[model samples]
Target: MSQVFKGCCAAFLYGVLLATSLGGLPASAGEGGLYRKAGGIEAYIGFVPAEITQGHAATQADKPMHDGVPRGHHQYHLVAAVFESDSGARISDAMVTAQVSGLALSGPRKAMDPMTIAGTTTYGAYFELPGADLYTIVLTIKRAGATKPVTLKFTYDHRNP
Candidate 1:
């Protein structure tokens, strides 16, 4: 087989192994978290507090806030990953962005940064929450080789926090 095919197979196996080791699929799968397929690519999206992301980062350092976001605002990181739906191979070459809106608040669509954890590539962006309210997160993913972008929307309840 060709080297590219071999690589894809390896990546597929890695994804399966990782999922198994984690005990099951991500909670996002059941929580209205964005999981969709288009143009042969499957996208998985999630959001978490910036503090949680900082804790996960190997550097363990806080990220600087964007100039416009006010201090003390609740900050969150949007995380996304793409995979080949058929083969389960992870796709790292993609342009990802997200917009958040709710409670009369709307955030700019921010470009996501690619991050690798345990050999898996995930894209993320940071956005600020104005207060404890319900928010809708929209993710747009343009995967390499795909003709059109895929959009995923999900509601996040921040009222409790």
Candidate 2:
């Protein structure tokens, strides 16, 4: 019991130190928050379209090593994270959706289900590209606390060379 208590205390202190270093920004203001600041969801979607295309092409042509495995011709995965705000450490239940155009892909636009974590939940959707090209991605989020739904648009150009 004492060891557990000590571990918890250390974690608490570490969190405090980290928060202080980060201007007291909540941990949720981490990656997802960064994504939001960089044009929010729309900007991220735009970046992904190209990333997926180029990534697929590169994998096919080079047959290069990736993700600790060999490359193959396959559809790229579209992962997304919907957060309330930079300080919103917890991901509330929200209706999140994603869609892509200019690519041939099929999968559930929304995540399997809303996931709850320590203080946040991320909705991730998986998709496969039909062909290599620039694709448009749209994301929409709705939560009870939010007065309006947050929507984002972006494009990606996948190229693997």
Candidate 3:
């Protein structure tokens, strides 16, 4: 594709992702998911059962090796999508890390790997979120061009949500 076409296509996908993911919510006020805007970057945090990743691997054999679903503790798949708040451009190269704590216990601080989904790039990591407890997820995002990284927190109520 031409350079102009690729730029327009990327911009178009960014807009679509913003519209569908944010769903008109300006910041972190949504019931379906967590979306936070702070320090010039917008972030979304979510998690799914780890089995979903394994299921996909079994069904999709043609997927690229680089896009493999991350595997670790294999309990939950934590995902985060980050973007520049001003331009709505996806931050694919950012260094993303997360720490999950719940019930007075905390998991080891680890880096989240970058993954591409449906032509969009996001960060993900595997964690073991067991039981029906309220979990606090703290995310730290650092970009190469930025002098300081941004840190954000989100609460996930496994019992209620």
- TM-score of each prediction: 0.65, 0.46, 0.69
Instruction: List model 3 lDDT by residue over 10-44, tens digit each.
Output: 54563455346533334334434477778988888
Task: Please report the candidate that would top TM-score against the real structure.
Answer: 3
Candidate with maximal lDDT: 3
lDDT score of residue 141 within candidate 1: 79
Residue 160 in candidate 1 has what lDDT?
84
**Residue 44 in model 2: shift from native, Å?**
5.7
RMSD (CA, angstroms), candidate 3 = 8.9
Residue 66 in model 2: shift from native, Å?
A: 24
Models ranked on lDDT:
3, 1, 2
Worst 10 residues of 1 by lDDT: 52-61
Q: What is the C-alpha RMSD of each candidate to the true structure, in Å?
A: 11.0, 13.1, 8.9
